[model samples]
Target: MKLPSEFIEKMERLLEDEASRFFSTYHEEKANGLRFNPLKIDRETFLTLVPFALSPVPFCPTGFYYDAHEQPGKHPYHAAGLYYIQEPSAMFVAEVLKPNPGEFVLDLCAAPGGKTTQLAAMMKNQGLIIANEIHPKRVKALSENIERFGITNALVTNETPEKLAKYFPGFFDKILVDAPCSGEGMFRKDEEAVQFWSQAHVEQCAIKQRHILDCAYEMLKEGGILVYSTCTFSPEENEQTIEAFLQTYDDLELLSIEKVHGIQPGRREWTNTNFEEMERTARLWPHSLKGEGHFVAKIKKTGPSPSWNGRYAKPNASKQMVREYRQFEQEVLQTEIEKPMYAFQHHLFALPDHCPNFDGLKVVRAGLHLGEAKKQRFEPNHALALSLKPQDVRYSLDLSSDSVECLKYLRGETIQTGEDRGWLLVTVDGYPLGWGKEVKGMVKNFYPKGLRIN
Candidate 1:
């Protein structure tokens, strides 16, 4: 694990006495962590269900450290949206944001959705989370992670920060800019980051981060919280970037981040102005914590903006489609969808609370995708199955995760259940995995082919 000489040289001069400890950590195994979905399962229940040996991540309540040898990602529970495998230090970013339920939040530059899902969990599926990513390809992973987490209130979008700022315009109560950086903190986890590390790249990332933060500021409401984070330790993207941002926006105040569990404060001397208040930001050093590196800064917008006067998403479901969906819902679901229903042609979706009309945006998922109307019948989507509780569905096929049948289900194989009950939710230990429609004595697998365990 060879590090760049220049990076090491700079760090050695900066740390001086502590540089040895930091460099020594590169020879050690990288830490692994997973955070459970509080929206679906509690911590005690998750511990009882999972077979892995785990330890608590001190900073994040939902986060746990798993052994590097363990393969939680390959488990059936992972498909069931039970937990997210994330870097322990990366989990600390969302904890700093602390989005509340029913608040309009934006996760700018969200891709492969680690922090976005955590923010969704904190919001408890009640708020509208506009999870936006710039790259088209990366946005797919972000949307997939959101779906796998059983998140129903998110509006996954593929759009640029500037474009989103134009559409939203001071609409969010809270925002998270987990800006793209040179990946200094992620070097241990992703080796490519190490290969890409350079001082010039760091400067470019800082410029991009400032532009993104400007977009975030435009979208955030007065007194709203905006958390800026990076996986890099470079002062150009951390203390210096925040310092420049605060200077540019006099109304934006840097709020103090409570540093605990070996978390350190941002170095004030790292900035151009040697800003003393820059110490309010937090830093997660690999040598100081159980995880790799990260930097987080929480700020507040004290200035006001014009109130968003956008139209809410209207119920566009036709009478026939509504009737068909209701018939399916009544026959299969014990609970009812109480939100406004919208239609994308034959597909029906229950819009999130206070959802603004995203008519022309590149929305991967609008809201809780109810299902699609095929001919005269309503076929429920896999998203619907994952979002449901076992008690919420009328019939289900519960299989032990260790059993061969569970593997078959995950592999998209039909199960031989001796029940004629139709539209059944398949579960692994009472957690909804996917949809399995029962016909005669055979249960047809509806687990998505793309997600099938080969």
Candidate 2:
């Protein structure tokens, strides 16, 4: 990979004797880290379910390190939505964001939904989470993952941060801008990333990062926290971008990140700029930590705002769509689940509030995900399906290990269950996997395909 002339010169001065070594070699260590999905199972239960071969990550309480020989994905617990595979450094941003239940949060660049899912788990599926991704292709993957993880509080939106800002000015209590950047940090994992590295690309990404941060700032309420993060190591995309943003928005102030054991803070000085006081901003170097390169900075919007003429315009769903959704909810899940569920757009969602305003923002999903009703029985959806308690349903299937594995892996035509007839909530060690109906000594599978263990 060819570094920009200016960047190379800067690295030469910064590294001095070690500059050549920094450029010549890449860190190739692969560490497996998994984030526990609190919505489906508690931390203790998740750890107990993990195979003994995978070691626990020492620094982060929720993160675990898997051995090279282990296939963590094949485990039944994985299909049960017990945890998610994530790089250790990538998990830090969500931990620092620390979203609470019943708060409105936004993930401006959410796709594949790692952090967004974590936010939902943290919120206990109670509050509103707007997971926005501008790219259309990635939205499918994001939506599937959210369903697989049984996240009910999330609403996916496909729109740029600029457009989103116009719809939701100061609407969110917490906003996370995991901005897109030149793949500097991912170069070790992906060789092609290094080939695309150039001065122009870095500068271009830095500009986009600034725009994303600006949108995040505009949408966050006063006293709200906005976390800006990237998977790149370049100062231009990291510290400098943040420094520029702080200079532009007086209402925003850099807040300190309480240090974790393995993570180090960002450099105090970069090029001509000094960030000594911005020690709260963190940088996880692949060389220094068990994971790949990443940067995180938490900033709080302070004081009163200049009242912009922006208001949230509620989304008007057609009466026909609403009526159909209500009937579907009433027939399938209204009695089966105790939570308040409603329909927004074409999707049904369950929230703490009776009626939520779905306005200018494009809402991909709205109410509690009651499984689609087929025949005379109601099937449970993957969303909030795993979180159901045993007594909440009329029937449940208890299957053997092989049957459970086959059902989880989506490889079985029929599952043997003790229940002769009636709908049964399938489970592994008391954690609800999903719902299944038993007929003639066989359990009908309802596990969503995207969520099925592969």
Candidate 3:
């Protein structure tokens, strides 16, 4: 890996004794970690199912580390949305943010929806969470993950962070800026990232990080919290960039995150620059810990800012889209699903009331996603579909040894649950397995084909 002269020079000046060790070798193995979704399953139950080689990550109660001998993805638990594959250090940012129920939040660069789903689980499917990913291609994965985890209170949007600030100024109670950075920290996991390593790349990433932070700050309401995080380990992109932002905006003060486990506070002094006051910021080193490198800082907006002056307009959806959504709710859901699903920039959503307030702001998502309703019946969304409790349904399978294993494995094959015919909810000791319509003494499988275990 070729380090930039300026970055290398900066590192030498910053770490007079440690400079040689910093850039000499590359650790090329991927860190192993997973985050549990508390919304669908409890910690104790999940731990019992994991392989012994995989141990709980001490820093995060919900996170775990496993040996690479087996593919966790191939496990039935993965198909159940029991956990998410994530870099261990990256897990801390969302935990530190601590988004509660009934608070408006944004994940500026949410994709593959790891942190976004974590935030949703923390919020307990209550409160509004807008997950914005700029790339259109990544939205599918983001949307699918949200559904897989049974999230009922998120609005997934495809837009840049700047566009979000324009539509919602002083709107969210909390915002997460997991900014895109040069893949320095990801070198171990992605060889392509190493191939692109250069001083020019680092400098370019620093510029983008600063821009992203600026936009995150603008979208935060007075007294709102903004959590800035990155997967890279560059002062230019981490401490230095934050210091520059502080100089420009005195109202944005750094707050300590001492409560989180598995993290050390940021260095009070970097290079020749001493920052005794900035210790509130946090940094995670892969070498120091069991995970990859990461940086997280919590900032609070103090003082009033000008009201957001952007034009507000209801999201316009094709009549066909609206009809499809409603028809599915009426027929398939059977229950009266919520209405006037929030719309934003050509998208429409329905969320439970537990979601946070969207009044006086541009709503990017609204309502519990009930999947798309169509043809007088509803097609269950992976989100709502995953949370269906067998007890909620009129018909269900009896708790048997084979039944339990089958459900746990997420096998597509149907089983006798003692139901004669009609819709039946499958369960393992009373957990929901979406819905299945039964006929001729057998239930038609409603488990999503893509989500079934191998």
Q: Which candidate ranks first by lDDT, i.e. highest?
A: 1
Cα displacement (angstroms), candidate 1, residue 365, comes to 0.4
Q: Write the per-residue lDDT of candidate 1 for residues 1-454, one digit (tens) a residue.
A: 8899999998998888999999999999999999999988999999998999999999999999999899999999999999999999999999999999989999998999999999999998997999999899999899889888889999999988888888888799999999999998888889899999999999999999999999989899999999999988889999999999999988999999999999999999899988999899999999999999999999999999767778888888998999999999899999999988989888899889889988878888888888999988999998999899999999999999999999999999999988799999999988999999999999999998889988
Candidate 2 lDDT, 1-454, residue by residue in tens: 4545665686678667857755554534555678777766677776676664566665556777776677767766666677888777788889889999989899999987888888888888777888888988888777767776777677788888888887777778899999999977776667777677787999999999998888888888888999999998788888889998988888888888877666778766862468675677998766566777689999999966445455332434445544554564454342444445454434445543422455565656554565443444334466656656655555655444345454542553457655575556777656567766677777877776555544
Instruction: Provide the overall lDDT of each model, using Cα atoms, as 2-decimal numbers.
Output: 0.92, 0.72, 0.71
- Which candidate model has the greater lDDT, 1 or 2? 1
lDDT of candidate 3 at residue 433, scale 0 to 100 = 50
What global local distance difference test value does model 2 have?
A: 0.72
Highest-scoring model, TM-score: 1
TM-score of 3: 0.82
Write down the worst ten-residue block by lDDT for model 2. Answer: 329-338
In model 1, pairs of residues that clash are: none
**Candidate 1 structure lDDT:** 0.92
Model 3 ranges off by over 4 Å: 1-29, 259-262, 268-273, 307-349, 352-367, 397-420, 426-434, 449-454
Q: What digit string (tens of lDDT, one per residue) describes model 3 on residues 372-424?
A: 54555445555555665543445565443234546543657665544455655
Task: List runs of model 1 lying over 4 Å from the truth.
Answer: none
CA deviation > 4 Å runs, candidate 2:
1-13, 17-27, 306-340, 344-347, 351-356, 373-379, 400-409, 416-420, 450-454
